[model samples]
Target: MYPAADTATLLIDGKWLEADDGATFPVTAPATGELIGRAADAGAAETDRAIDAAAAAFGPWSAETAYARADVLRRAHDLMLERAEDLAVLMSTEQGKPLKAARNEVRYAADFLAWFAEEAKRVHGRTIPSNRRGHRFQVLKQPVGVVAGITPWNYPMSMITRKVAPAVAAGCTIVLKPAEQTPLCAVAVLALLEEAGLPPGVANLVTTARPEPVGERLLADPRVRKLTFTGSTEVGMRLAAGAAATMKRVSMELGGHAPMIVFDDADPVHAAKGATLAKFLNTGQACISPNRIYVQRGVVEAFTEALVARTATLSAGPGTSPGVSIGPLVDDAALTKVQRQVDDAVERGARLVLGGTRLTEDGLDRGCFFAPTVLADIDETMLIYREETFGPVAAVIPFDTEEEVVARANDTAYGLASYLYTRDLGRATRVSEALRFGIVGVNDINPTGAQAPFGGVGVSGLGREGGVEGLDEYLDVKLIGTAL
Candidate 1:
């Protein structure tokens, strides 16, 4: 049994309590498959209690001045920095991201808190001219009450912060349901908010293996005015349908099969390096990660060779290990999925230039580790080219022209993110506009920040999650007409 110190209890109505049935589930480290701790396994009744708490606290929290809310967020940001090391270790242990990357994720999460803190006071309204004399018209902005945030296991800390920070800054109370595999990180974050003096019921957390009772109740409850989620497109569609029954506001950041195009005009070595970094970041588990690589025909061979050389240098092991360039996948299921995709591709005439198997080095036999692989001669019929490969596998397809590459890149139903590299400014500008994605990067692999709008078009999901647009997701606009 995990000791109390390693476990995460529920936070409901400002009180740390266990489930009504005293139910709990084990939290295992993906890197070692060892039991790290346990989390409260809350059900519908507990979710209802948390919702009631948020409903009760919403009035007072929303009534406070925007600056007052900003102060609380700023305090939380400072506390996050104070606890960054502990949080980073926790994330690395459970979520299987590299330690350095985990620490950076904490900083990124804190940045969101800081950004939203300033944005709270800047939620400005507009004045409109009225046709009638002695009449004035204006639009006002206010928080959307009681939010239910359902976040994924990948990037656990930042995902929660991205949703929670904006909700809190906009003067809304929230009930957060983190992914079952990684609730410990969420608990760590909740502790910081409490220490930062967030009022009781303003923020609550419930962890459970089953989403039925907890997640279902959260979506169905009318008191929960807005629902935000980051997960697969299949699950998002189901949640959206359910939330529609109550007509609650909904924002979702779903799955993606992002394409990375390397033009012949760009430096082969440079493009290859950037592509490798983008494809292997977070072990290629990110939604915006490059899944399909389109290299121009003239440089396909050179690009593929350089990509293999760079990828071969990446080390795979437990995230806590010192020089781990790649960490284990989140679980056995993820590992199996990646394996099946790679196997299918190799069987279908694709050449594996470098790694094409699972890794079991450095005590990684017990963990879910996959080798960084590169495949070439892939056509549209390959599964890795069509589906989203959420692993460290790069499938490079050759393109004859810019128009052909654009068409190939936009062939998928998902359009979350895409990237292109070319020295020709005209070509870069033209392709950037033509790509059907929410976020595009030209000569830049990582374009995300707290200051930009991050979201996708098509099946990638609805709404944005950063910048002024991010704050707007948690607020509602009202128009008023007054006679003077």
Candidate 2:
């Protein structure tokens, strides 16, 4: 996984071009801080070329029938599944998730392409009712011109597919900027699309270490009709604001401080297992990871015991290692932030039930490894209660009633995903409906998919990313009336 084939060029127009300034950035594995590859550090000029190429490609690309676009996407999907091992290896090397998890992500990424490939054929317009007897009315869904997609490092392959697949399926050309930390994956994805018979310039890639300047250009460009981004809340807001200045259609899948609530009626062990999986998957780096855990007072003790015990079993190591469920934080900053959050939580009266320190022993000294942490007695007064830790730390807060827990869970500026576990169906229904998140998992920790609508409410950012609704984000509607 460490010596994956390194890609070091930008995909502008139909060609792979090196930056004119010859700037490059080193890509190191968070698992060991080992330099795996180098990527071209694109800047404003490269971004401008990518946008211009996407705009030029949009005309012929969008003019193609939906079925044609679907054919290319379908071919890419097959190629991904065919070359799954290579992609998974590269993903593990670059992203620091387990090889198994990387494999799963590769499949999930391919699944998006497959989902949208079939969905593209169903992009249908409709006949509308006419008020006048001698007139006809029609509604049409057309591709929004050029699309600029900015993706994050976590689940790099899947995020790109989740974004680019829909935009392509909707017959829109795109310029993609993958997270600088993991640009090789994006380069690999564009290569697959190229082999899938996608016309050159239909999908351009701009890999850059400096995103602000490149992002500013993408958002400010009048030719880029749509902007889709998946990253931090602060960055997403700034990009959304810039897009608004150009009146661009913007969809942002930003940060989340997801809540997982367990009722007393639930089996404490079962709820704990669900909570462990939801909280620690991808080492708790996922946007939808349950950052906050709420348990009813009657079940809190058993839940905490089970959760702590289960979390202790998660081994944080190189993602390439065997049976390793948890992996290193993506960088030193992430490790520092997780450490700060845990320290703040403990200082504010929360109990560190287990693991509150960074991992430096047992050959973990070189990596950004934090132990799988579990804290109890978390309260609203604690900093961890409000911030998205984005690490493998679970802070448990005990609640008295369903009403109180729901109120506590909804108290967040971010609302991307939430979860509830209860044996009582009525309680589950009532609680699920009460949560103010864009997504709720009732008795289910993993609810999102290629076909599901993935996004958020409030400052969690704008628009949906998956399902038919995702395609709509890359499209514009028009009503046409003709006199008979």
Candidate 3:
């Protein structure tokens, strides 16, 4: 009962398909390492078929009226809400986020569909004054054509929908390759789109463990005019470089090392609670998780105490278990990375203020389990502060003045999201301006939404995922001039 009986198949050309080579890959529960099921392991041959399908469907899909596209997206949005619980369970079972978080993710994911549905109707063209007499000039927004998307396992559903919805809304056809680990959820979501009147070949999906060679097929074909991806920064750079050969438009949402600064004027307890939510959300696997937490010296002790207390309450276990706020890491590799960071932090003289060991007792030995950890007096030299600790670990560094903290926070190569909690509006505004991140939350930790432009600057990658900017990524502009 882990997933549907036909989970081990691909979605190509509006039909569930088996890999031509009959290859399959195993998908296991992150909590128990139990075999959920296998998914079709699409190779280059199957990959080409999906791309061909998207190319075939692009003409019809892009030619449809904006209202027609909106109708299909709106129906998909309603169906997403109707099956929210089921999708949540599928995400929790495969991706290891808590069921509660999973429920929230699907709801959030559905918003993209709804937002883009309305946005589709508003893809208005603008008229331009022509320099020549008796001539009219206008600019048109048209779909960029066949789009290829590759998403990571951390955000199985939302990432896929965020890319697919806008592309579909913009009148472009899509051939999506979701992360291999979480393909079932992709299958379930694609089913909704198909049921909601998405025509055959308008949207296609292929799953495989080896995304490199298979995903390269998407970039290799000139018919795929755009490539949208969300993953590590290193891979994003590679994909961007690959797409350049064919001059395909690429949207890359890559790595992030977010910073959260807690000033003395802010409520220590409130900031601590927000830190807990932001740090341990999705077991810190999110790209926008706060990697470094800066505390003003005046209230460092109070904030630390409250943060430890809040973290202590979170129980790590299977995502579906009752009262479990935290769940296993996605796999052993993630666990190893967390362990390495913690070890390095300890070796660098940081104090472990709370739990830091692996939770092997109490029936969690089989899965990848690490206790939620906190390290204080962390410096920028340490790996926990320098690199992304994509686990349930928080790094705390104490600071004094606003200028000093702003410099410290902006002293990173990757600039994605940053947060600051301060009642002093002047300080908040000043520090936010100084920070080099794309998205800054003055007092709120939850800064991203379906209607907001979610993206980053610098090595964090290019393009936005939400809002009107996201819709524009799948569209190309054309200038038309006519003699009157």
Off by over 4 Å in 1: 1-8
Tell me the whole-model lDDT of each prediction, alpha carbons only. Answer: 0.92, 0.90, 0.91
Tens-place lDDT digits, model 1, residues 184-212 = 99898888888888999999999898987
Which residue pairs show backbone clashes in model 3? none
Q: What is the lDDT of residue 403 in candidate 3?
A: 85
- The better candidate by lDDT, 1 or 3, is 1
Q: Which ten residues in a row have the lowest lDDT in candidate 3?
A: 1-10
Model 2 TM-score on a 0 to 1 scale? 0.98
Going through the candidates in order, what is the number of backbone clashes in each? Answer: 0, 0, 0
- Regions more than 4 Å wrong, model 3: 1-8
Residues 1-484, candidate 2, lDDT per residue (tens digit)?
1123344469888788777798889999888888988888889999999988898899899999989999999999999999999999888888999999999999999999999999998888999888899999999999999999999999899999998899889989999999998998998898899889998889999988998888889988899998899999999988888888989988989999999998898999999999998898999999999988999999999999999989988988899889998888888899999999999999889999999999998889889999999999999888899999999999999999888889999998999999998888888888888899999999899898899899999889899988888888888999999998
Candidate 3 RMSD computed on C-alpha atoms after optimal superposition onto the true structure: 1.5
Candidate 2: residue 205 lDDT (0-100): 91
